[model samples]
Each structure stands twice: as structure tokens, then as C-alpha cells.
Target chain A: MSAPLRVAVDRDACCGSGNCVRTAPEVFDQDDADGLVVLRQAEPPESEYDAVREAAYNCPAAAIEVTEP
Target chain B: MSDTLATNVPTYPFGNAGLEPLLPDLGADGVGRVQLPTGQQAWLFTRHEHLRELLRSADFSSDFTRPGFPLIRPIPEDMPRRPDGSLIRMDPPEHTKFRRMLTPEFMIKHIRTLEPLIRQTVVVALESMRAGGQPADLVEHFALPVPSMVICHLLGVPYADHDYFQERSRILLAWSSPPEQVRDAIEEMRDYLTRLIAARRDEPGEDLISRLAAERVATGEMTEEELVGLSVLLLIAGHETTSNMIGLSTLVLLKHPEQLRQLRERPELIDDTVEELLRYLTIVRTGLTRVAVTDTEVGGHRIAAGEGVIALLSAANRDADVFPDGEEFDLHRGSHQHMAFGFGIHQCIGQPLARAELRIALSEMITRLPGLALAVAPDDVRYRDAVVFGVQRLPVTW
Candidate 1:
């Protein structure tokens, strides 16, 4: 089986557009206080892989990072 | 690849006659030099990949005062240019400071909290239009008022004064408005916002302007002048862009009855429908303008430090490689990657709010007004000659 996906977010670089949260709510969320990305799951399940990738791809600020095994 | 020579460059802010503006041939690389109405020559990138690179690059500056900034219209010579806290026209770390201050206010979660307010506003607009009977101007009755009232409520601006601000905003946005008129409009908007800011400072309320006045301005985190500029930007941008999108999206949907039927059948598709409509109608027809602060190579073209570049978002949204059969409107086409709200740091900050408004407004329109149809012939419809693409009036009946 493939290794679990790795995800990271840079709050400083996050313009807080929240595309990540919308695209992959299971893996990501917006901080209620600041609206920056809050990494809910650093290693999400296989089912969330596609959505996680799309989130990284579509993020306007390029603040989301994903690593696949 | 052919290079568009300076002598033969096409004029931009292309005409709005067709569903999509006819873009001039920009050679194999999808990059060309075009002539602005100001008589300035700027590099135009039409391809999706090229726009992503150009917009995301930190070497480009959004400051209009910069030498070689691609100005779509000529500014009056005597008008003093001070774009203080106009976040769209600013570059980091200044842009960051202002954007961060307001990010929490517009995040999806915060916008979700405003859904009740948006729905109420939408319902009120629909009912009001219905009260006027059939064959009403949908634009004047529904499209303009919903966003105007919502934004005014959020900013503590009086909706009764919408005619005044809306008229000035029209002049500010119209390409045909003379440079002097544009200058006067800006002054008038600034003067009005200045008074509003002063009022908020003295008597704080539960609104954005009051909050900013009490917190940021009072704490010296931002200045009153900066607040005035920011308020002016939000006030104008809040209503105009979304208003145009609502009007145009309705027209597009009414024309595509099949898709409209699908949306009505599956209300769950409202989210995807909103995305597709935004992608298809990339309303900022003039495109986002920026000037290079450092030499950069984009799409194999060497752009010098002082050169201006225009990211044609409309062209990029319809790039064939990204969206197969991009020309056709498909409600099922997952279009999250489209640059309708633009890209990178300067991406539309009000997008989440815009999305909520569009989803509620369009869904309500289709559901409530079952027999909605254009009262005038399709050919008789008039388009606005403005920075934003929209119908001058949408005469409709249910």
C-alpha cells in the first residue's frame, strides 16, 4: 500500500483565500481567528488524496504543499 | 513564433458583442504586445500557463504610479495619484498588511455566517421585483439592489444613498467617461467615505467601517486616509463586480435552458454552477495590469524590469489545454482553477462573499421565477461599455 500523504501549509504565505478548506475540508480548515489555513490532517487517508492534490493545485497563494508516496 | 510588432498592435478592452471577446492572434506562445487606449504598449499573455507564471511572480508590481504601468485609460494630468491602502494597486509587504487585517472578515466560514443575511436580502430583492409585476428590468429591480443593500449593511453605508454612490461608481467604471469625470468621481467617492470614516470613529457600530475605525485606525495600525481609500475600494468593488456577474450569469443561464433546468432539478449543483458561471463570464474584461520590477522570462519571452504586462484572465479561463471544449458552457465542468477572480496575492478578496451572494441569488431566481424569460429580443440587448462586462438592462418577465 502507498504511504500516507504528507501536507504542510505556510500561514505567512497564505493570502487566506480558503480554496484549500473548500476543496479538501477533511484535510484542511481555516483558522477561525485569523482565516489562515489550519492543517487539520498532516497525513490524510487514501480517499482524500485526490482532493488534497486538487487543493494544492488550485491554491491561489501556493501556500499548500503535498507529498505523495 | 511571431512577435506582435508595436506598429500593428490591437487596441484593448476588446468589444463585448459576442459571448467571448474576439482576441487578436497572439502567435504560438500566446504572448503578444498590445496597444492600450492610453497609447502605451504592453505585453499581453493569453495562455493559462503564462498567466499563472506572470501573476504569481513576486517580481511584478501592481502599483499604478510605477513607470510603465499598463493603464487601460488615461488619467487626467492634474489629478494627484495616491493609491494609499488600495490593496489591489499595492504590492507587499504593504499589500500584505492591509489584506491580513481584513482576511478574517471575508473567509468562507465568516461568509457562511452571513448566509442568513444574504438569503434575506435575496428574498427581499425577488419579492420587491415581483411586486413591480412582470416585464420588469431585472438589472434595476434585482441585480443591482441585492448586492448594494448587502454591502451597504456590512459597511454601515446608507442604502438610501445608493443612487448617489452607484451613479459615481458607474462613471468611475465606464471607459467612455472622460478622464476629468473619472478624477471627479474618485474625489467625490473619497470625500463621502472620509465623512463616513469620521462618523464611525466617533460612534462605533457593529460594521466593518466602524470596526476598522475603532481598532486599526484608532490604534494607529492604519491611517484615516488609508481607511478612506480602503473603504472606497471596498464600497465600489463590493457592488460593481458582483452586480455585473449576477446580471450576466442570469442572462447566460436563461439562454441555456437545459443547464438551468439541471440546476433547478439538482439544487445541490448550485456550488458547481456558480464556479462555472464565474469561469465562463470572466467579467473583468480589461484584465489585471502589472509592471515588472525585475527582469523576468515568461513563456520564453524576456520581459524587462520596467515593462508592463496584462494578464488576460478571460483568455486564460478559456484555454483549450486546461478545459477541453472550453468555449461551451457546461455546468458539470469542474472549474475551480479558473482565474475569474484572478490569481496570486491580488486575487479578489471578496470572492467568498461574492460566491455566497451568487449561489443564493441565482438559485432563488431560477426557483422562484419559473417562467423567467427575456422580454426583449436577444439581439436588442445592450451591453455596458465599462471595465466590467454586463448588460445595460436585462428586461425580463416570469
Candidate 2:
């Protein structure tokens, strides 16, 4: 089996546009308080890797980071 | 220069005047005060770093009703404040709530699926332009209709209503429009959207309003009134800004034939070229407005609560610190860092759609009109005196 994807977010840089959550809700979410990203699964299952990568690349604020760890 | 910014907010199309020279007068610290058309003094942020930070700050709010929120022009005191859920003027969870519901529709991947529709729309628009004969106005023929038709289709509004909506959009966005005229245009827009939403609720389609009606509104997650407001926001913003960019960017490229020739020769440069044009033009000439909800420090300057702040996107987009040789437009520069879409949570939800439209439309313009040249003298071209900077009409001939 392939390695799962690891996701992280720099909340400070997050402008709260929520592109991450929309792209990969299983791995990322918006904080209820201020709409910043909330990491749900640091390492999501292999099936979600495509979406996680898309989220990282498409984050308008460049707040999300993804790696295969 | 400072006097002009402080007393009489300067006219639109700041053009190559590119906010760089005015930085010193804005302040050594990159933050200072300037006056708005509302005849109110507000803080203006000029540097890129400071603008990015301020846009993301929770201490600043986009709420229109907030004291010290900068108004581009005055609104009547009797008018009701903008609806709570309008995308442009919301904060945090509220903004996030609305944005999340709409994000799936505008995601780059999803918008790419609409490329065929966008391409078809452009082809039809160009054909219509040709039918109008030579020495035609690009604004009416191509710039305005393509976006208007695309937006109408996306929103499920009738494309036949373009003249009606376009006229209303122009009046609403005009900087010097009388308050009563602005109010009437807004009312007409809201009423039109309200009717459209009601119709969509009864018989749904594949468009955004239909989707919202079936998913959000029917679920009680969003109210009908809020949906109507959101629809108004989309219809107006979707067409007005992109249409303006299409017109003005064409004018900019036509004026600089060398740059135009370069883009035509290197088709791969279109992506970078579009970004460069967005950065260079930075057409939202009114700047992003916000108010300090709490005391905050920006660029070493402490702003009190309730103080208005205007982040000069046009200035920051051209900041030498971020974009070297920032004043000049170079298509191959390949840098996409631009405040053309504003920033933060409220940063244009429709940006992906806008970018796709711009790339396709501009590329098609060059390929289809190889001999495209200005029909009018550069000085004779009329520029719209509006919040969104654009040419009023660009007469072009092959």
C-alpha cells in the first residue's frame, strides 16, 4: 500500500477562505471560532491523497502544506 | 500628492501612476491617513507585507455597518445596511459559512469543466463583434457581453436581460452616480434577483441559484432573503469586474504593441501574461476597505478601534519589495502574487472563474484579431469614472 498523505496548516497565514476544507474535508476543516483551518487528520488515508494535494496547491493563502511521511 | 489623497480622492485609472511614487508620502512606516470620497479621513496601507497581514487580521472587520468602515461614496442615511450575509462585507464564521457553501462551485478543477462553455461564449461574442462591422466598440461587442452571458448562464438569469442588468451594473458601480440613482439600481437588482430565485425554487436548473435553492435554502441552512442577496452579489460582481478587466487590459495591450506582439508569439506566456496584466492593472481602484474592530498595530502604526483602513491593492501589487521592477508590465515575469482579488477570507470567491474567463478571452482576442488596432486615438478613448477602473469604450479596428 502507498504511504498516506500528511497535512499541516500554518494558521497564521490562513486567510480563512476555506478552500482546503472544501477540497479535503476529511483532512481539513475550518475552526468554528474564526474560520481558520482545523487539521482533522494529519495523515489521511491513501484514497484522499489526491484531494489533500489539491488543497495544498490551491490554498489561496498558501497556508496548507502536504508531504508523504 | 498627499494633499490630493487626503482631500480629494483622485480619479480612477491611476494607470501607470502605479502607487510607487506616493509611498514616501503615505508614510515612512508604510501606514498613514488619507481621505475618502465620503469626506472622511481613513488610514491607508501601502506595503505588501502590511496589506497581507491586515487583510488576515481578525481585529479588522469588513462589516459595512461598523463605525469607520471606509465608504467609496456616500449612501443615504435612510437606507438599510447591506444584508448580513453579503460576501463582500462579512467576517469570520458568518463569511466562512456562506463561502463554504459556494466554494465547490468555483474550485479551479470545477471551473475548468466549464471551459467549453466559456470558450463557446467567447466565440459567439467575437462573431457578434464581427457582425457589428469594423471600427466597432470592443466594450459593447466583446468585453461586456462575454462576461454578462457567462454570468447570466451561471446564475440562471436570462442572457436577454444583459442590457437591463449591464445598465444597472454601470450605474451602481459608478463613482459619481447620484445616491438616489445608486439606490434605485440596487433596488432593481434585488427585485430582479428575488424573482429569479423564486422561479428557481419552483423549477430548478443546473445553475448556481438552482443548486443553492435545492441544497442550502431548502435545508434551512440559508434563508431565501439571504439567497436573493447573494444572487445579487454574484450577478453584479461576476460581470462588472471581469468585463472591466477585459476592456481595460485590451486597451493596455493595444497601447503597448510590443507587449501585445510578445504575447501573440508565445502562447505559453498567456498564463503569466494574464497574471501580469492583473497585477499591473489592479482594476479595483477603490482599494479594499475595512474598520478596526479593536485596537491594532499595522506596520508599526497603532490604529485605534473604529478607525477606517484602506489597503491600497494597486500600491501593494506594485511594491518593489515583492515584485521587482514592479512598475513595468512584463508578461514573462511569471509571478502571480497579486492583490488584484483582494485577500483573506473575503478574497474573491469567484476568482477561479474570473481567471479562466480572462485567459480564454484575451487569448482568443489576439488569435482572432491579429490586426486588432485602436480605432480611436489613445487620448480620445473614454475611461469610466467608476469604483472599478476600466475603459468606457474601446473602439477597435483591424
Candidate 3:
């Protein structure tokens, strides 16, 4: 079985490209005020691990980070 | 202080002659004062690090109406902004509010749904290009129409009106275009969009404009004037940037036949190649402008409050520190760090759609027309002297 995953976003570095939200809407969202990255779930269910990772990789600002297995 | 200002920077000749000369030489700090096409001087940030920092800072505003914003050309103070203005020209809350509503439309997954349609359009354009025979202009036949039709379809604007919008877009982006002509174009587009939005109100379709009307307009979350503005922004931006990238990227690849052959041989490389070409080309020379609302330090240079800042995206894209051997056009480098789409809150929102179009159009063009080659001498091919870098015409044969 896969271990739980963690998600974090450096809002300061977020480019508001919306790639993260698009890739993993379950785990990420854009702030209503500034469109910067907003983590919807710090530790989303294991089902979201792949999409969370994809968002981290595809983010133009490199703002999304995922850690632990 | 004015006497000490450096000579105004010229924004022409997209190759080395244009941005290269303006950029601070390598190993030097890359921030300095440079004049603009408006004859006003501002601090130009050339290094990648500096631009990234400035762009992310809230203090550096993207408000076009700001007193010190670096417009390529001056618009009259009384010239109106669309009710909500363009997302690129707004700061924080307002920009974010509008961007959130529009974000779903440009999402990669959403854009992918339209891939088949985009592909179909490309195939049709290519067939017509073939029927028109060799030595045909690719710009008119393929590059321009594919994205134009896609954007128009997305907006529910009639594709038949492409000639109208395309011409307006051309005048809007042309640096030499008079402000009066530019305003006239904007007024006409606003009128067109306003009428379209009103029609969509009664009987909406599945397209973006219809969705916007249903979700935002009916709810009073967005005003009609703002809807018109947003539609105009999407229409012009959707077609202009991608179309130019398509034309210029094709011209670049055709000029490098060996590289084109590599792409044809490895179709999987299409995605990376598009990113690399976007980085390498870094077209759209002048639109990335901002104004500092408060005193700030960028690259150790103290920029005063209300000072304008122009981040020469092409220069930053090639900054050797970020993109090693950045000057070379190596597609396999696989770096998506380029500022081709600008960055931060105001980054090009239509990038996913643009990327899909490019990846499809370019790969399909090479694969379908194995014999494709330029009809004109490399040097004789004309480039547009507009804000977006593109070939005026690409006469090609296979």
C-alpha cells in the first residue's frame, strides 16, 4: 500500500498560471483575491498523489512541493 | 538627473541586433535604466532572477492606468478602460477575481478536449495549402487561421469574422500603428463583442462566451462592459500570440532542417521542442510592462516609487545563469523555465491552448509534408516590426 502524501505551495513564488489547480483540483486551488496558489489539502488522500506530483512538476513557478512517500 | 539617463532602448530587429545589444553584457549585473518606445526611461530588468523577483512582488503593479506604467506607446489619460479592464492590466484582487472565472477555460485538461477539433482544423488547413500548390504562404494558409478559428469558435464569435478581428489585432500590436487607429480598432472590437455577448445572453451555447454569460453575467458577478472587455482580450490574445509563435517557430525549424529532421524522426519530442522553441524565440517583445508602487530593490538597484519597469522577457529567457548555454536552440534541453509567457499573476493565461496548437500544428506539418522547404532566401524572408515577433509571410514549398 502507498504511504500518505503531503502537499505545499509557496504562494510567494506562485505565478498564477493555474497549472496546479487544473492538474490536481482536489489538492490545489487559486486564491480568490490574488490567484496565487492555495493548498486545498495539506495531506490529500493517497488517490491524489499522482496528480499532486504532476502539478508540482508542471507548475511554471516551481511553487508546488510534495514530500514523503 | 535627466542628463544622466542612458539612450532610449530600441525594440526592433528581434535577433541579436534588438534585445542582445540592449541587455547588459554577461557577468555584469543585468539591471539598468533604458528608454522605451514612448520616449520615457525606466529600469529594464534583463536577468532571470531579477525579473522573477520583481514580477512576484505586489509592490510592482501591472495596472496600465498607473501613472508610471511603461506603455510602449502613450494612451490618453482619458482613454477608457474596459469596465473591469484586462486581467494583465490589473493588480491582485481584481485581476484574481476575473482570472479565477476564466481559469477553467484555459486549463490543460479542458484545452485537451478541444485537441481533436484543433487537429481537424490543422488537417483542413494543410489540405488547402497543398491544393494551393507549392510556394504558398504558410502564414495565410495555416498559422493564422488555425488559432484564429479556434479562438473564434471558443468565444462563439463567428469564424467568418476572422478577417475583421485579425486585421484589428494586427493594427493593435503594430508599434507603428497610430494611437488613433489603435483606439478605433479597440472601439470596433468592443462593439462587436458587446453585440455578441447580448445575443449569447438569450440563447447561450457551450462555448466560453456563453459559459461566461451564464456563470458571471447573469449572476451579476461580471458586468456587460467587463464581459465585452474580457472577450476582446481573449479574442486578440488567443489568436495573435499563438499565431505568431506558430509562424516564427516554423520559420526557425525550416531554417534548421537538421533539427526539423530530428523532430520528424522523434515525434515524442514535439512537446519539448515547442517549449524550447518558445524559450528560444521569446517573441512578443514589448508587452511585459509594470510600475513600482513603492520603492524597491531589484538586482541591488534601488528603484524609486512610481518608476516603470520593463522585463525584457527574451533577454531573461536566455540568461545563461538560468538556462545554461541559453543562446543555443537545443530542443532536448527540456527546460520549461523560460519567460516566453511572462510570469507571476499576469502570465499568459492562454498558454495551454497555445501549446496544444503549436505541438499539433508543427509536428503534423513536418510529418505530413516531408518535402516542406522555404521558397525564399533565408535573409529575404520579412519579419514583422510589431510587438509580437513573426514572419510577415512564409512562402513555403514541398
Predicted structure with the largest lDDT when compared to the true one? 1
lDDT of 3 by residue, B39-90 (tens): 6777777888888787767779888777777766766556675436577777
RMSD of 1: 1.7
List, residue by residue over B112-157, the lDDT tens digit for candidate 2: 7899999999998997888889999999899999998898988899
Report the Cα interface RMSD of each model, rounded to 1 decimal.
0.7, 6.2, 4.9
* Model 2 per-residue lDDT at A44: 84
Better of 1 and 3 by TM-score: 1
Model 1, C-alpha of B109: deviation from truth (Å): 1.0
Each model's fraction of native contacts: 0.60, 0.08, 0.20
Candidate 1 residue runs with Cα over 4 Å from true position: B1-5
Most DockQ-accurate candidate = 1
TM-score of 2: 0.85
Measured as a fraction from 0 to 1, the native contacts recovered by model 1 come to 0.60
Summarize candidate 1's per-residue lDDT along B275-363 as a digit string, tens digits.
Answer: 99999999988899999999888988999888889999999999999988988899999998999999998888899999999999999
Q: Of the true contacts between chains A and B, what fraction does model 3 have?
A: 0.20
Q: Candidate 3 chain B TM?
A: 0.94
Docking quality class, candidate 1: medium
